[model samples]
Target: MTTAVLEFPGGRLTLNRPGTDDPSLRAWSSADELLLQEAFEHLAIAPDSRVLVVDDQYGALTLGLSPFSPDVVADSAQLGSALALNAALNPACAAPERVFSWLQPPVGTYDLILLKIPRETDYLDWLLRWSNGALKQAGVILAAGMIKHLPDRSVDVFARTVNVEKVSRAVKKARLITCSQGEASLDNWPGIWKGYDLEAPGARVNAMPAVFAREKLDIGTRLMLPHLKPAIESCRPCARVLDLACGNGVLGLSVLAIRADIEMTFSDVSSQAVLSARSNVETAYPDAKASFLHADGISGEQALFDRILLNPPFHEGGVVGDHIALRLFEQAAQNLSDTGRLIMVGNRHLGYHKSLRRYFSQVRQLDANPKFVVFEAWRG
Candidate 1:
C-alpha cells in the first residue's frame, strides 16, 4: 500500500495500510485532519490535562494528538485493530494503554474532548451524556465532520446542551463546532431509545441512534430470534455465551433470561449499541453476570465460549457488502470451544449457510422467514 504523509499542526503523519492488495477502503477524510489541526491551533491543551477522543477512525486524531494525554475511544473492533496496527507502524508515539470500549467512557473528568460526529444519532446522544458527566466545569469540547454528513438537528443538540461556536470552514468540506460548559443540565438529555421487545419476558431492546435498526429490530435478527430455543431439552446450566455484533443485546439478554446459569458477553461495533445493550441488560437482569464490550465482532479477545450467538452485520456503513459478516463467522469459528455452537441470524440473500459450512462440520437451518434465515453450526 502507498504511504501518504499528512502534514499537520504539530507534526507530520505517515499513513499506510498493512497489505498491498487489501488497501484501506477509506482514508482519514480531509474533515478529520482539518478538525484535529483546528483544535490544536485554537484550544490550549494542558500538558497534564486529560483528553478524550470519540469515534477516531484508525487512530488518525488519536495519533495526531499523541503529544497530549489522549485517550482513544471507539465502538468498532475493526477501527480499534487499525489503531493498534497504525500505532505499531509509528513507534515514536506512545501506545495508549487504555482504550475505552463503546459507550463505556473512562471514569475521570477530562479537560478537552475531540469528537467525530458519528452516523448514529443514538450514539451521539449517549456521548452527550458522557460529555455531561465527564467534562470539567470549564472543559472544552470540539467536534467536526463533513458538512454533508452533519445533520440539521446536530446544531440544535449542541446548542441545547452546551454553548457552541461554529468555526469558519477550512477546507470547504468540514466545519468545527466548539462547545463549553453551559447552564444546561444533564437531566434533560433523553438517552437514545428504539422500541423493540426481546422474546424474554420483560426484556426490552431500545437502541441509541447510532446502532443499525435503531427504530426496531432488524428484519434479519427478528427472523432468527424466534428460533433460539434452548439446545437442551431443558435449558442447559449457565455457561459462557457471547452475543457477537450485539446491537442492543436483544439476543444475549433474551438468552440470559431463559438460562440463568449463563454468563453473557455483549459486543458490537457501535459504542451506542454497547451502551444501549448494557442499559438493557441492567434493566432486564440486574443480577445477571454479563460483560459489555464495544468490539469488532470477536477480534479483540480470545475467550472461549460454550455458545456464540450473532446477528452479524453484512454491510459496511450501509453499503451492501459481505466482508463484515464473513469476518464475524471466521472469528466465531476460531473463538468457539470444540463443542461450542455458533448460531447466527442473517439475511437470506447473504448466503451465510455457505460461509458456516466452511468452518463447522455441521451447519443446519434453524428457521427462516421470507427475508432472513437462522443457521446453527457446531465447532468441531
Candidate 2:
C-alpha cells in the first residue's frame, strides 16, 4: 500500500485514505491540515488533558493531537483501522487513550473537542446535542470542514452546544468554527428517532445519528422492497441469511420481520451501523437469531448463507466507484450455498448485472424503477 505525507508545525505524518487501495488518493484533506494548524496555534493542552476527537478522517486530527492521549471517537471501522495503521507508522505519537463508537454515548467531560463535520446535518446535530453534556463548563469545541460542505446549518448545530467564538477565514477552501461550551443540558437532546414505520406490519426502525437513510426510506430500498419480499419468501427453508453492508440492519431486520424462521446476520464496515443494527434487532425481536458483524467483506466467520441481501455502497470515503460493490459481489458469491441466491439493489447507472453475471451461474433482474434496479443471482 502507498501513503500520503502531510507535514505540519507539530510533525510530518504518513497515512492511507479510508476504504481505498490507491495510494495516489491523498488521505488527509486541506480541512484536516487547517484543523491541526489552528489547534496548535490556539489550543493548549496538558499531557493528561481529557480531549475528545470526533470524526477524525483517516487519523489526521487524532494522530496530530495524540501527544495529549485524547480519547478518539469515530463511526467507520475503516477509519479506526487507518488510525491504528498510521499510529504504528508514527511511533512518536501516542495512540488514543480510548476509542469510542458513535453508537455509545460520550463517556466523560472533555476540555477540548475536535470535530470534523460530517456530510449529514442531522448527524452533526446529534453529535452537538450529545456534546452538550459531554463538555466541561469551560470546554471549547473546534470544528473544521470544507467551505462547500459547511453551511449555516453546520454552524447552527455547533451553536446548539457551544457559543460560537470565532469562524476562521477560509484557508485552502476550508474553514474552522471555534465554540465555547454553553449551559445546555442533556435533557434537551434531539435524540435518535425510533419506531419509524416499515412495510412489514408492526415493524419499526430505530436509527441513530449518521446511518444512511436514517430519517426516511431510501429510494433504492423503496424500489427493492417490492422484489425483496417475494425473493425472501421463495427462498424457503433458508436457515441462514446475510445482509451485506447492512445499514442500521434495516434490510436484515425487515427480512427477519417477514420470515421469523430464518437466522439473520447483519454485517457492515461501520461500527455505528453494526451497533445500530444490533440494537434494532434485539429491541424488535429479542429471540431472533441475529448476529451483527463489524467486518470487511465477511473475512472470518464460517457458515454459508441460503440468501444474501445487499444494498452495496457505491462510494468509498466520498469517492464514487463500483469497486466496493464489485468486491461485495465476489464476497457474496463465496459466502453463498450451492442453492443460495444473492439479492441486491443498485442504481441503474451502476450496471451491476454485468458483475452479477460474472459471479453467479444465473442472474436476472427482479425489479426496476426509473433510477434503481433489483437483481437476483443464484450460485450453482
Candidate 3:
C-alpha cells in the first residue's frame, strides 16, 4: 500500500487509516475537502473563540482550521493518533488540546460548530441535540458529506434541533448543510436503553446511540450465543475470554452472566461502543473481572486468552470490505492460548472460513442459519 496525502491550500497532510493495515483506504474523501473549504469560507473564529468539530475522520478539518484552536471530537482512538502524528509532521497546525469522544465533548456554547455527517441516524441526532445547547445564539453550524450519505433525514435531524439555513450545491458530489441556532436544548438527548436478551434474561444490556445493535440482539450474535454456551461450559475453570470487536459487549457479558468464573475482556475500535460495553458490564456484573479496551482489534494487546469471541466488522467509513475482518482474525490467532478456541459469527456470504483456515489449524462449523453462520477454530 502507498502513503495517502491530502494537499490543501496551505499545507499537506499525510494520513493512514486507524484499524486496518491497508494504505489505499487512507486517502481523504471528497466530503472532507468540501467541509474544509466551506468552513474556511463561511465559518469564522477569532483565536480566542470557542469552536467545536464533531466526527472528523482524520485531521483534515481539525488541522485545516488549526488557527482557531477548535475542539475536535472523534470516536476512533486510531484516528486521534493519526491527527496528533499529522500535526507533528505539519508544523503549521497544532493538534487539538485533547481528542474528545462523544461521551465527553467540550463544554460551553461555541461560536462555530462543524460536523461531518455520520452514518448512524441516532448518532447524528445525538450530536445535533448536543450542538443545540453548545452553539451560541449567533453561531453557525456547517455540516458536509458525500451526497450518497447526506440524506434528507440527516438534515431533518438538524431541523428538529436547530434551524436549517440552506444546503450548498453539490461540489464534486459533496454537499454542505448549514444551520443556525434554535430554541431546543440538550435536555432530552437519547440516553441508554435497557433490555434483556433471550439468552440472558436476568442480565440487562445497556446501549447508547452509537453502538451496533443498540435496540436489541442482532441475529448474528444471537445465533452465536447458543454455540458459545457449550464451549464456555466445557472450558477449564478461570478461563480468560476476549470479546474482540465487541459491539455492545453482549457476547462477553452474556457469557459472564452464565458463568461467573471467567475473566472477560471487551474490545472495540469505537470509543462509544467501548464505553457502552464497560457501562453494561459494570452495571450487570459489578464484581466481574472485565477489562474494556478502545483499540484497533487487539493490535497492542500482549495478553493471551483461552477463548476469543468475534463478530468482526466488515465495514469502515460506510464502505464494506473484508480487510478489517481479516486483520481481526490474524490478531485473534496470535492472542489465543495453545488450547484456546476462537468462536465467530459472520454473514454466510462473507465466506470467512477461507480466512480462518489461514490462521487456525482446525476450523469447524458449529452452527448456521439462513443468513448467518457460527464457527469455532482452534489455534493449535
RMSD of each: 3.6, 2.6, 2.6
lDDT of 1: 0.73
lDDT against true structure, model 3:
0.79
Q: What does candidate 3's lDDT look like per residue over 305-346, in tens digits? A: 999999988777776877778888888888888889999999
Q: Write the per-residue lDDT of candidate 1 for residues 1-380, one digit (tens) a residue.
A: 44566677877777654223244444477777777776686555455678888777667788888878588777665666777777876787665787876445577888888888766555555566667677898888888877777765876677676777556555768777788766655465556466676555566778766777766767777676666665521334667788888877888877876777788898887777888888988888889999987666676465788788888766653246666777777888888877788888888887888877877888989888888888889865
Segments of candidate 2 deviating more than 4 angstroms: 21-24, 42-48, 185-188, 234-238
Residue 290 alpha-carbon offset, candidate 3, angstroms: 1.9
The Cα local distance difference test for each model comes to 0.73, 0.78, 0.79
Worst 10 residues of 3 by lDDT: 190-199
Tell me the deviation in Å of residue 34 in model 3.
1.7
What's each prediction's clash count? Answer: 7, 0, 0
Error of 2 at 158 (Å): 2.3
lDDT of 2 by residue, 60-130 (tens): 88888876677888876666667778888888886775667765646779987888888777677766766
Point to the candidate with the largest lDDT: 3
Candidate 3 structure, TM-score to reference: 0.90
